[model samples]
Target chain A: MGEVKNKQVILKDYITELFKESDMDIVEGAITLELPEGPNEVLLKNLYLSCDPYMRNRMNKILKIEGPATLLVGYVWGFTKWEEYSFVPSSRILFKIEHTDVPLSYYTGILGMPGITAYSGFFEVGLPKKGDKVYVSAASGAVGQLVGQFAKLSGCYVVGSAGSKDKFRFSVFVNTSKSFANNLILHASPPLHLNAYLSTTILQIRYFPEGIDIYFENVGGKTLNAVLLNMRINGRIVVCGMISQYQSAQPEGVTNLKKLITKRIRMQGFVVRDYYPMYPKYLEYVLTKIKEGDIVYVEDIVEGLENGPAALVGLFNGRNVGKQVLLVSRE
Target chain B: MGEVKNKQVILKDYITELFKESDMDIVEGAITLELPEGPNEVLLKNLYLSCDPYMRNRMNKILKIEGPATLLVGYVWGFTKWEEYSFVPSSRILFKIEHTDVPLSYYTGILGMPGITAYSGFFEVGLPKKGDKVYVSAASGAVGQLVGQFAKLSGCYVVGSAGSKDKFRFSVFVNTSKSFANNLILHASPPLHLNAYLSTTILQIRYFPEGIDIYFENVGGKTLNAVLLNMRINGRIVVCGMISQYQSAQPEGVTNLKKLITKRIRMQGFVVRDYYPMYPKYLEYVLTKIKEGDIVYVEDIVEGLENGPAALVGLFNGRNVGKQVLLVSRE
Candidate 1:
């Protein structure tokens, strides 16, 4: 009876396209049923597929694109074309999912890259002190949401920016309600709904009249310039991603950067993969916050694998309200 | 004999001008027959004068500049104008120089604004860590000389840039010969001599091949751009003066400031007067170094008060080799 039930299931796995437009190809392959023979390589079913702005770089052929996945390209010397699959040989890339009582989709959003990114970026790079005013760009997105919550926990005056009015309202509401780690997001400050472009500039001037001490910069270009002007002396800018200029043929020129000298600002760019050492501790803290209802986890889940194209493309346009994730399978 | 000596002295009192082009009016005043009864207001006969780049700001009748006496430009709000005979307003500008063991000329250079600027900027702001790379612009000048020495004492790799080839060689000689507490300027690289236009930029690049950990920036403009590009992660740039842009109609726009983001650079402009609390300690430490021959002091002593004008103006043109000090009442 068990063999019959297993055979009838016919497990369907999520497969991402190698190239876009006319060259797009999706692999129809069976899910690997092989279990871990040893301590290494825990077979993850990838129940919730993380759809990030950075992943857009991985979708195209490496030579033609640049971003987080370029990390893999540096090691992989030559690839003829993006045909069948992209495999990265690593001693460890997959980790066993322990203590999985909460929603599995949490792994794709808060519990994964986004969570650890906020953790390292806020503490290690941003260096947020108690009572510091922090401004996070793309506040409703995966990394941005967690960073805003973390700032609140760090005893900072946290103000966030999102593209749509709905997402901005939702983020403020979620944070104020203590959806993420019982940390208080100020209920006051009359609903900060701003256009993504004007929001980047106005939030800097309005929210940070004295100037922003820390900026978790996900969207770059004019946002960076505005932040540069609105930065306090010794302000810290953590360059998580430049999503705004990612699709452009040429990187946008930032003119007002000389303000860094007058303001004594410190800015740095980093990738979460570089800081894997803190992942275990980060996972423990984040998951605890989730289970205790101290940290609220939100995911804009696309129900099926077929909608991956629209969801992935929508990242640039700030379409997702929360972490844009695809529910591929149920473990 | 006392009366004859007093008459022979020709008590030449000076009054500083409120505007730049105004002559420093010298008044023929009678000498005091007896010492005035006062506690800490020992009358100092105008002896030697220090001409500095900072003093140019004081020459202009602009907004109230908040810095050393040399940099302060207002309506002679606190200071006795050029060639003006006046008593020190004890409460107004504190620490009126009393009986000094050293030459009163030292007050204008080593013991005055530039001296404290060097002491405060190098130790307090630069925060020279052991084995850190240090770069100083305007090496032969007052602040640059002391900063280089301080870096050496901190067990840092120090390199300095001067305008003249002679000054460059002299700094190298001083770096090697000095035995101050921190006199350990590592001769890992060649000394840099910069041209007027590309001076700051090329000097920054050459001095900090691995990128400067601390930059004592005296000349701003293209140099700032170079320093921005060549700064290591967490590098500190102390903007003491913007000599390059001081006379320009508009400040030269520095373009390469985007490097600050990637490098996590910190650039700060400071006035040495903010560090009055450490004056006594700085005086003691520097005097000790001078007395022990551990730190070598150099001055461009232009003889005759008539030559003072050329000496003072030479600073902006990079014509003055060392501290531009004029001999009035010579030893």
Candidate 2:
């Protein structure tokens, strides 16, 4: 078997708090070019690796899973290893890319995990009807952007919230007021009442004066508190991820949960891993939308497997503009 | 038309803080004891009044819904003038008491609002299965007792928590350690981490060490924080009420909300009103369960309409042992 150098990002140690680049080290490991002796295991040349906040929780030694090596012909955005080459079970590679007319790197985002997350969470959990008002937090991220687009495509009025002015600008279809973005930064660390500007009518009157029908929760903490107050009776909150709380030593307490009883709200938390069965159906719908140009995807790609640590760490800081991708190989 | 002295409990004014017996005035007003001129309006003598915590929120001016009235009923524990008699539309009355073979006052406890609250919250929202592990908060109160019984009837293992040692004794089938009940009071006001004892392994090991499959959330704030940490994957949290937070200036923050993502929990809030249609179906089921001694209900009945304020306020303080009912008239 021919051997090739596999450059990998190794965790230097278990992380208990906020993630740093120094927490990981670049290791030069060697991989056999051939697949392992099994009926299903395949060796793959990793192309696009996704940098997401969920990865932070799995860094704890208790939650670790072994990964790397597969002879896969196509691509996916599922878990493998943080390396240039990987050998893994064929089943571990979630969905094989069937439609290549779109960019292959799109596997890391809209055509992959984030895509199905938006699809199932919005339609299955949120159950939006026509003319419903939708609010999405972390609106320019991989999952949030798609949720906003899917809501818009379904004939719903959509409003979005993001941390920076740049994210509000980057999100083309989902509209959020610049003042709201400023307030997000301005009220980042204040007590909830002091953080009450967005939770009150000032933001509500401008965005959804009637109140929100669906709230897509990506960033938790203060934003969740505001959204809870702004939700209409029978509103649905689809909790996909809570990026804002990932870095904190202890996530801030959310105080407005009483609204859940008052409003008869249905707030559900979901993980995309349980929803892989929908990926084929999602691929069928999303591919058509992308080909027809009815939906658009924005990506911020960083080149090289060695830079994966920095790119992944940037997510909690909101440094990337869209679906953050690490380019490990081309062709 | 007949004129009679109708002793009424009138709000002194809108209350913005803790409720007191002084905030209500027992006024001797005159009632004609005749229905208003409408096809549906009717007049009737008042009997039992259910004193629960939800009325605390309705005391605010903004959420006001005019109440009191109705003629045609054997007995019911719905809203009415806290006086000797009432005149209102027949539609204003919720469910008419069809079965009075048990105590006529039961319409205020197991046969009325709290009955449906427990039934629907556990069966519909909770969706318990045989062999599942369930947890209930406020175990001796109106709703919690029935939820525990329903879980046991479904062949599931159940545990409950309440504010006082008396509540533990007052609840029937649900078994909770005395230590868990004590912690509910001990950690009542601490920060989430300092309040982490119950949220950690001590409570989990003693209770559902396998982790809770269903959590019936009656007392929110710190209790909800603890339950979230001890949930199994794919668990469901049916939030029927948040009694602990009713009197707080600002409700405490729950920090373990991240468990919602890690465990993929479905936390839902429901008001009892939406499930009223299920009342006929519920009444049928609960009646059979009660008659067979498959379930039992406890009532802490106080005499006089004048004592309503004390009974209502007692809910927040956990002074009452079971479902607190105010006996306006025994007939």
Candidate 3:
């Protein structure tokens, strides 16, 4: 019995609870070594934790709001150390992470839900037209990188926003540099309208001065409110994330919704699960782009499971650049 | 000069502007006898004036707003008083007064611009699918009467609001008295939701009980604000007029446009000119229905040129029970 137990693999997972305090508690849960019974289920030793805007929805008890509520509450509650979580991700029914050629930690960032989100939203709802102006917020983060690249591939004028000058410069350099390196031709066309000379920060300031036809919304707050005023007539806003407002007790104020009437804007929210059917097509297309050097991928990888909590928490503070992923173990 | 004028019949007709405050000044522009130029432009005597909601656009100082603002303002200004308004009498250009054996005053009310406004807006924009709930403000007026009748003809369960109970009862009675009314034929199903069994009223409170799917908006104010909140998902609002706000110094507060986002409602402001091409088919169909007793046609015929101002003003006040037309020089 002692020998069998010695051979057994023990896993450490982070958790929080129904405590009144807003801080997350890293509580321990029962570790299991036996294989999950479900045929499709993959026993993934979670290398990285994804902190996303949609997860905020799951944090709150589901109110019958007329918008898309969070689907992540189950996972949040399951990992939370509480006698009554009110929700939990069922062990056998969890979405399993499949094999990826890139760093497994990418599952928490680019190769995970956020990447799929950016891909699906930009391709589907945005319906990017060649030469159309594209705007993205939190451009240095997980989803924004892939979205900017996708926009470039689709022959769109992509501009993105980030927190610091370093991050902003990095995004711009990466965007302008990678496409050239990838054999994806990046040519400067006649600057379209008033937005031609503007930087991502100024573009955010002007909310796409000439007017953004397509917006990949991530960081929501005053930025979103600003974007609302500048959206062109018949604009499309893909509600990818509202990261800025995720931790706040109150949602951000949106004053410019009246523009929706005159502009005929379509703001749609969606989850990656809805895009699973297009996975093969997406994988084939994105993988080809990556292999051909048309896609420049970056990651801020944290080594060891001990550093996962700090790395994950640092995301809210904009402490990490590119995709923040934790290297749980070296196989 | 008298001898020269005597050779031709001097037709000094006094044309009145339907809307007094309109930018179109009803000047009695003098003209000597003129030869008929074409079949389309009929040089009819300035007999009666058509007071309509569409005329409001003509009265506005043209602003550079999106859409054909110039064209709309120009069209409205073209209807100035005492001017020989030469227009195509074809159903494509004007909603011709069918069964011309009726009073020329009918051209302004039951058979004129307002008639087509009611017809096109209610049928085309409203798209009243059978069993869908409908709400029509100014239900006793020119446009609202036809809207209610058309909804009923399309096998829709209809409820309309008027200033008085008499007009309300009359609108419903018109539907009941019709020999081939859809409600009388195969009974249309009730609304699919639970909150559709309440009585509609001129007061906005009536909306809280049963949400409206199609709002044929002729009156805008608290009524519109109420409708905004009560609109179901994908609801359609046809903005035919803002009678309540037109005469007011300030447009009424619309605090509930946020509902439009969640509901995905489509509210459009359009003129009858959009549907003018269909006038021939519309008139033939509408007249046939009236003749076949499938639809009821109602109007309030105001007597004499002196009463034109009173009748026009009555439109805003909701004093007129049905279509308001001034009978000037009788045909």
Query: In terms of TM-score, which candidate is strongest?
Result: 2
Please tell me which predicted candidate would have the highest lDDT against the true structure: 2
Candidate 1 ranges beyond 4 A from true positions:
A1-90, A93-96, A124-129, A162-205, A217-285, A291-331, B1-62, B65-83, B86-89, B96-103, B162-211, B233-274, B300-316, B324-331
How does model 3 score by TM-score?
Answer: 0.59
- Per-residue lDDT of A1-331 in model 2, one digit per residue for the tens? 6998999988888878877999888999898888579778867778888877678777766878433221225654556878887766767655566667788888878877788888998998889999999988787788887888888778888877666322322222333332222122222433333225457743487677899999988878887888888889989999888877777777889999999887888888888878888888898898988888777787999999888889888887778877898888776
DockQ, structure candidate 3: 0.09
Q: Residue B296's C-alpha lDDT in candidate 2?
A: 78
Question: After superposing candidate 3, which stretches have Cα over 4 Å from the reference?
Answer: A1-25, A31-45, A58-99, A103-152, A155-281, A293-331, B1-27, B36-130, B133-285, B297-330
Best by DockQ: 2
How much lDDT does each candidate structure score?
0.59, 0.75, 0.53
Interface RMSD of each: 4.8, 0.9, 6.7
Per-candidate DockQ versus the true complex?
0.14, 0.72, 0.09
lDDT of 3 by residue, A192-298 (tens): 31122233445545335578888787766666666766777667777667666556554444544444434556565555666766765776677677778787766
* TM-score for candidate 1, residues paired by index: 0.66
DockQ, candidate 2, vs. native dimer:
0.72
Comparing 1 and 3 by DockQ, which wins?
1
TM-score of chain A of each: 0.75, 0.88, 0.71
Error of 1 at A211 (Å): 3.7
